[model samples]
Target: MAARSALAILAALSLAIGGCASQEQPATQPSPGGSATSGTTIKEGLKIAFLPKQVNNPYFDTSDNKGGKPAVEEFKGAYSQTGPSEASPSAQVSYINTLSQQGTDVIVVSANDKDAICGALTEARQAGAKVVTYDSDTNPTCRDLFINQASAEGIAASQIKLISDAVGPDGGEIAILSATANATNQNAWIEMMKTELGKPEYAKLKLVTTVYGDDDDQKSFQEAQGLLASYPNLKGIISPTTVGVAAAARYLSGSEYKGKVQLTGLGTPNQMRAYVKDDTVKSFALWNPADLGYLAAYAGAALASGLITGKEGETFTAGKLGEYTVGKDGTVLLGDPFVFDKGNIDTFDF
Candidate 1:
C-alpha cells in the first residue's frame, strides 16, 4: 500500500511538471564535419563529467563519489568529476569553461546560481556538450534536461508535517535554516513551505525567521546557534538543504535545547543518524542521493547517444533504476523523499 501511494505521487509530479520550467538548451545537433539529419547520432565513446556545487561537501560527495561515479563505470563511459571548493556562481564558471574546452561529451551539474553560469553553459552547449542539471538547476535555456529529485510541493508539505507533528497541535514559534540566498531549489521549496503554513490547521505556528548558511558547515552551525540565542521561545526549525540540516543537527544535538526544540528537514541518513539516535531529531527526509546521480548519468548518456532529443514522451533506460521518460520541458522525475527516524535510520548507510 505504501509503495502504491509513493508511485502515485511520482506519477502526479511527472504529469504536473509539463507546464513547469525545464527548457533544454537546444535540440541535438549533428557532430561537426559529419553529414547531418534528425536521425544522426553522436559518436560513441562518450565522455561524461559531473560538476556539483562543491567538492568536499558530504552531500555532493555521496552523490558524486559513491553514486554517480559507479553508475558511469557500470555503463563503461569515460567519467570525471570536478567542482569548486566552496559554492558560488562565479567559482563554477571557470570549471564550466574548462569542461567545455576539454570537449566532454556530456556535462552534468548542480547549478550554484541559475543564471550566473548561463553564459558558460551556453558556450558549452555550442561546443557540442550536452548539459544535464541535477540537485539544482541552471536556466531552462542553459541545459538539456533537469533531474528533479522530488516535487517542491511534496517536499515542502513533508517538512511541514514533520515539524507540526514534533511540535504538537498547539504549535509554537519556528524558524528556517536554508542554503544560499539564491539557490533555485532552496528558494522554491521555502516559498512552498510558506504557502503550506497558510493553512488553517497551522495558524498557531508562527515563523520567527529564515537564515542562510551558504551551505557551509561552520557557517550553518553558527547560524543554528544564533537562532537558538535569538529566539528563546523558538519551538522548531526546518532546514531544507542537506548541508544546513546536518550542521544544524550538529549544533542542536549538543546544546541545552536538544530535546526542547524540534528539528526537521531534508538530510541524508549518514549525516542525521547520530541526532536521531540521541533524540535531537525525531524525523528528517531526503531521496536517495546515489539514485539521484545514477539516474542523471543515464540521462546524460541518453542525450549524448542521441537516444532522445529532450522531447516530451521520449524514453530511455537507466541501469538498475529502470526506464524513465522525458516529460514536458525536458524534465525527468527521480522519486519522492523518504522520511528517516531512529526506526529506519539504521537501515540506510548513505
Candidate 2:
C-alpha cells in the first residue's frame, strides 16, 4: 500500500508540468450545462480541493490524507479539503463556492445530494474547476467524472452474500441500513440489492424493510436499535456505509442481539476490527478508502492535465492500480469489493 501510494504521487508529479490551457473555454469543456467536447485541453500545476459529504469522517480522512495528499504533493498541486462538519447539501455548497472563489483547479467531491450541489458545481466548472465526484456522486451533468469504488451490483451482491452466509442459505429476514436517502451510490446499491433479492437463489432471503441513518453515527445507532425493535424477526442487516456499519456494530455489541442478529456491510477495517473480534459482526466488505482518494486525485490530475477527456474509450493510468478507461456516463469502476473476516482481518490495517 505504501509503495502504491508513493507510485501514485510520483506518477501525478510527472504529469504536472505538461498541460496547456486556452484563452476561451477549451474545446473539450462544455458550455456550462452542456455536454463536454472531446479532446479539449486543460492546464497543468492543478490546484485541487476535496469536498467530501462532511469533514472529520474516518473514511474520508483515510482516503484524503493517506491517498490524496501524497498524489497531490507529488504533482505539486496545491491541495486542500474543507467542508461542513455535517453532511448536508447546503454545507457542501458553501465549501464549493469558497473553493471556486479561491480558484481551485479541480473540485473533488462526495456529494450529499445529487441535484442539490449541481448549481454550485456548475458555477465551479464555469470558473474553470474540473469537477470530479468520488464515493457518492453528483448528477452526471454536474461533474466531469465519477470514481466509483466498485460496481453497484458487485457491492450489493457482496453485502447480501456476506449477510446470507452469516445467517445461512435459508435466509432469514434482513434489512438495509443505508446512508442518506439521496446519496447516489447508496441509493443505487440499495436498488440493486433489492433487485438481486428478487432472484431465485435469494428467494429464501426475505428483505423485510429498509432504513436510513443519514450517515450519522448516533442516528445510525438509533436506527439500528429501531430496526431491532420494529422487526423482531429480522435476522441480519447490511449497512453499506462506514459510518452506519460502525454505529450499528456499537449498538449491537452491547445488546442481547450482539450475536443473535448478524451485521455485515461496508466498513473500514480499523473501525470494525473490534466488532469482528468480539463477534458483533461476522464479515463485511469495502474497497480501500485511501485508494479511492488516490484514484480520484489521479483522475482529477488527468482531467486537469488533459491526459484524457472524461469520455468513453478514453484511457489513463492510475498509479499502482494500473490503467482504467472511462466508461459510459463518465464513470470509472474501481474494481471489486473485498470481504474482511476474523481470519484475514488481522492482515489489514486500513
Which one wins on lDDT? 1
Model 1, global lDDT: 0.82
Q: Which digits, one per residue and each the tens of the lDDT, describe model 2 over residues 1-350?
A: 11234344333323321121111121222222223344333344688888889889999997787677666765557778888898776778888899999989889999999999999999999999899999998889999999988889989898888888899876789999998888889999998999888888888998888899988999999999999999998899999999999999999999999889999999988899999999999999888777688778878987877676688767666654556778899998876777788987776666
Residue 130 in candidate 1 has what lDDT? 95
Candidate 2 lDDT for residue 197: 84
Residue 230 C-alpha lDDT in model 1: 98
Candidate 2 global lDDT = 0.81
Candidates' lDDT values, in order? 0.82, 0.81
TM-score of model 2 (CA atoms): 0.87
Tell me, by TM-score, which candidate is best.
Answer: 1
* Candidate 1 residue-pair clash tally: 0
Error of 1 at 22 (Å): 32
Candidate 1 Cα outliers beyond 4 Å, as residue runs: 1-44
Clashing pairs in 2: 28-40
